[model samples]
Target chain A: MIDIALTEEQRDCLQELINVAMGQASDKLARFLNTFVHLNVPNIELVNFDSLPADFTENYAQQNLSVVSQGFYGNEGIRGESLLIYKVNTLDDVAKILGYEPGEISDNEQLTDISSILTTTFLNGLAELIENQLSYSAPRVVSSATSSLDDHLKQLSFDWDLALKVDISYMVTDYSFDCDMVLLIPGEAVKNIQLVLERILKEY
Target chain B: MDLPQINQFLVKEINVGIIVIDAEAKVKFINQFVLSNTDLATDYQEQSLFNLFPELPEKWLKRKIESVFTLNTPAFTSWEQREYLFKMRHTRPITTENDYMAQNCTLLPMSNNADNQPELLGFIIEDATDVCFYQKQLSQTVEKLEISNRTDSLTKVANRRYWEERLAIEFERAKRHNQPLSLIMFDLDKFKNINDTFGHVAGDTVLIEVAQNVAQNLRQSDLLGRYGGEEFAIILPETDAEGALVLAERIRLGLAMHQIKVDEGTVIATLSLGVICICDDYSQYEEMITRADMALYQSKRDGRNRTTLYQA
Candidate 1:
């Protein structure tokens, strides 16, 4: 478990690194989608469980389903967590990217299929962003939307008590789609990130 | 917490609806901005989201929130593009100890000094209606301008200026290939007489008809253009003098068979044709065109309703 936290300067460096990594991800996604994609890591926050707002408890007591993937940067020595939250159907973004008239999706089965395709596409793009240094866990598909994402996170067994949340926003060509990419990294990984920066500085 | 202080501090400052619920998914916090912007019920505290935006997928929203608390991971809703004109927004679970403020749903996530769970996942909604509408208009305007520049005003075919620019390059290519370039030139048999007798309007009708007739007879690769008033030209690559003569004869016969009528029962016209094939000795495009003009004059000399080939 990581015990050290990053300084404000270090946090800034982390944000810049994430921006670069996500920018690369955007390029790959753009090529796959046959449109230009843009990625930005706008905000990064360090959070603990009890420090969280009261709404979180009220919302998750009954149902919670989520998918989480663990990736480690061998060179940077930083390990991070990626979560895919699919309580909401992702096809809205897809339809927006298609730039067509809105069509209704009546059945849950159709929503599931669309979500799976979208999740796979996003994960594939995220992998390219990390320069293949990270591998994604197979997405855990579930129907009890409330319990699934949280359940998946529990299965990963990572420390949520000492994690940094990286807030990301990505758009595919002309803001056709705007979505959130939330990455959680352990507090210990922050020290590793500092070391990586030092190494990079030395090399430069 | 003073109610007015909360409302004034909350409204319109952030770009997304702020709905805060305690551990039970009951509305614990509803900012004024959420009340004004979204269609959610105003009496939101302790009220379930299912009771509010019934149209929203409540089960999915609950699942996303639950996952965020459990894994201490921020769960995200898919980008919800507003139907009318608002910006895309999504809700994510934020857990910070000291900051009980709902998710900082601005375009930029708010920074904080919370020691414990500082994962303030903001719900960001941007207004893209104006931007999108203007961008679409810009694209349409560009397409319209492009179309107008390439179309001819009279014949609706590619204009003489475009043809001259394009064919000069083709002529250079033909010279490189050492291939024959044939030209067929035609003029209305008594175009001046028609203008004098019937009026300029009749002359124009006759010219339009002649252009259509010659255009129909030529191959797709062959070029046809109105070289000047009552005069038309055609360029046929890899065609010899004999081939050009045959094509010229076809144009003559085609025009002879087609007649344009004025106001009364009187028929309007016929056309004289001239054919010339470019040889290795022809140094310039102007020279080839001059020879074609001479052949056209010869056609008028021999008789008006037939084609004549340049013999030198």
Candidate 2:
């Protein structure tokens, strides 16, 4: 496995980039759902595939989650998969926003729709700032409400040994609706991202 | 370059519906599949998609398409997620179950040249009716299996194994919160005599009737389970010794008054119940069960058809 690490400067730059991206994404979501979307500070981590399950379980083991995943690729080796993890308990609020009766089918629909909106808006904003033109695969419902994050993470077949994991959480202001968007840039993509960060840092 | 004709033929002949719309969601190009599936006439070019299909979720679809255009990426919706984007009849012969086709749709950004930004959006609607049909059946079977696994086949209440698991969990929760929890253990009076004289089938009928009667009398939060042959147990969370004794007496009296008609003749049953409430000395749930059993023994010794509260 290749060793991947980000300097304090690089991490700070990436964090700043994610903050701006999250703001743009939340604004779009607020307009669409007519609800104030609260944003959390983006957490950046370098994760190994072996310890990924343990890391995920530490925070989300107790939660039943429905996850939507989409893959994106761009020039200069900029590629990663974005996961939108929705707590099953919060699906009722999402169903209300979508104007549907809360049930299994409606829950899955709301998860998919909201995930798509968040993933595209956030990734597009980040891609623009980084000067990379990225294209995404269709967003897919990867895990249902019956599964936990630990189980889902264990089942994943990761081709990359290491990943730059970025975590951002969104909470609806009044309602109990909360979700997390995680971006995993794997292996060589980390190096590519670092070079872009360094260039941005140099310009500063 | 020579494959343009083939490409055109492939696009038109494909089973899936393909449509290309500009930023305004007006149809720039539409294939034969979409045309055949819908009730539209010949002149459909330049028409807004919402005008073409009045049933479309205009606000949501427009936003989705706009997102794809802005991000230059594909977006997908499965039948399980939203059923279908357009209300089209499925070509499948069996149409009794589903009224409209189940669809999995993909929206892609389309660009004429490699270097230019995407100017149009392409929509591909694939028929997912067969997949959806099989998936629903599988889930239904799974749900039924899950329920049966935790339920007793004879009584339809929770089986001994599942009941014990709940008991352990509730016991720990009670200990942590220092809350009152009660357990009632009971058996039908002279149940063995009924099986010997009226046969096992009659005994089964008696057990079923007794289970139904007890279940109907309990609160929603209480769990009743068949613990052993002719023996049943109840777990009452947030209930004290007095509450447990009251429920036990209700069950005992209710059964003694009602007559169960088996194949042989009418049989009146009675119960001997042992009740135990949570105390500091009782560290584990097994200890509570043992004490409750001891109290049940006392009830049996002092004659049947009575409730005995364990003195912890």
Candidate 3:
């Protein structure tokens, strides 16, 4: 595989900043839930863009997963999407935590609402912690129904040669509440991200 | 009563349900919008959220909530995907169409202080039933309008304009795949004479019945359209010259056998059909249709109820 264009140091720095932002975001969530939240440092990968959906749920492909996505625009051609994926089986737990009795109805409106809130907080946190200001569109759920992420992959409108994949798993530590969030940065944004990281390194 | 008190007031009165879950997976707080709106009678404090909203998917909810609880990243749910996180009936002030309430839900991670002290899951649920209802109505109307525009008013068959577009598409596809394509233009023989002899009513009956007869003989993949003023056209994909000839003769025979009874007497109507197979020499789709129309003219000139093929 042609390695990602970023140097090892640049990649490590990017991961560190991403983790910082994730921590900041989890702090907001922890206060919201009146509980402690746990976060894992994202597992970063550089892969061909075609392999995104499959790479997202390689471990839990058998279970039904919900995908919510939001697009963002950044400075100096830094642009990409943040996708959130989680199993559908935990939707009941989500309804209860949200004080909803969604019942047996499938494809309900509340599903989008939950994804929107989580994606927004996440993208914003990741943006702010990296010391970059970014504009975001409202979050949307592109796939659900089946466990396969192909529907999600097929519907993606944009084109990209390569992507910087950030995979982070979060849970409440005690409960079985687990989810994976993936951030996709395109080949075009690699230079911009490197510039931002370098500037941070020099200033501090 | 500082900012937090005022914020609590807004959460209760803002017309959106607010539910907060603590780190222990217990209900921290549910605002008035949620408490008054739902059918729950018991106090929600310290209650397991799962017990209250039992239908909520256990796997998805736990994963999302705990993610926010730990990762500090917020998540969202739109009505289009999950419908309603709760089983509340639609309460929007308008016509009732939806069975369950439509809601846009937000899952927020909140920390008590600047530091990640005691964290809670903040949920904001908004009623979206009316919006969803109007959107559905709009798409349905658009679909109906589209269907009507493409259909012939009298026979409920596809109109000439729609057929022409399909013809061009079929031509390109046939060329790309190196498959044989055929066209047939059929006309009710001496239709003007029928109108003069039996009046316009009989002519109309013959036209409708002729279209039905020709359509019944053709395959499902074939396209049969009213080709303007007593003429109809059929496009057959992947069909050779012989297949087109057999179907054209079958339709001519079928129409001649069926008789229409008007106010005066029984009228026997026959159709003259012209068939042409698209050859490698032809570049434009119009050439194929024009040749079929010419062959139709030949059928009419030689004898009334016969089928003719275009000759080189």
Give model 2 RMSD, 1 decimal: 5.2
Task: Give, for candidate 3 chain A, the lowest lDDT window spanning 10 residues.
Answer: A104-113
Name the runs in model 3 displaced over 4 angstroms.
A1-122, A130-138, A141-204, B1-5, B92-94, B113-118, B197-202, B262-266
DockQ of each: 0.03, 0.28, 0.21
Best by lDDT: 2
TM-score, one value per model:
0.41, 0.78, 0.65
- Please tell me the TM-score of chain A for candidate 2: 0.86
What are the candidates' interface root-mean-square deviations? 12.9, 4.2, 6.6
Candidate 2: list runs displaced more than 4 Å: A1-43, A61-66, A72-80, A86-111, A121-137, A141-146, A157-160, A168-180, A184-204, B93-96, B113-117, B168-180, B258-268, B279-284
Writing each residue's lDDT as its tens digit, candidate 3 over A2-107 gives 2357777777777777777777767766665555778776777777766765666576667877777777786567788777777778765665444455563344
lDDT for position B125 in model 3: 86
How high is the CA lDDT of each candidate model?
0.56, 0.82, 0.75
- Residue-level lDDT of model 1, residues B1-312, one tens digit each, is 699977676664765565555445565665655555555555676776557655554453454344333322232322212222122222321321211112222211112521133233333433333444454578789898766665465665556676666568767878999888898888888888888888877777777767777788889789887777777788888898998888888878877887677764455478788888887887778777898899899989987888889888
Of the pair 2 and 3, which is ahead by DockQ? Answer: 2
lDDT of 1 at A39: 64
1 against 2, candidate with superior TM-score: 2
Colliding pairs, model 2: none
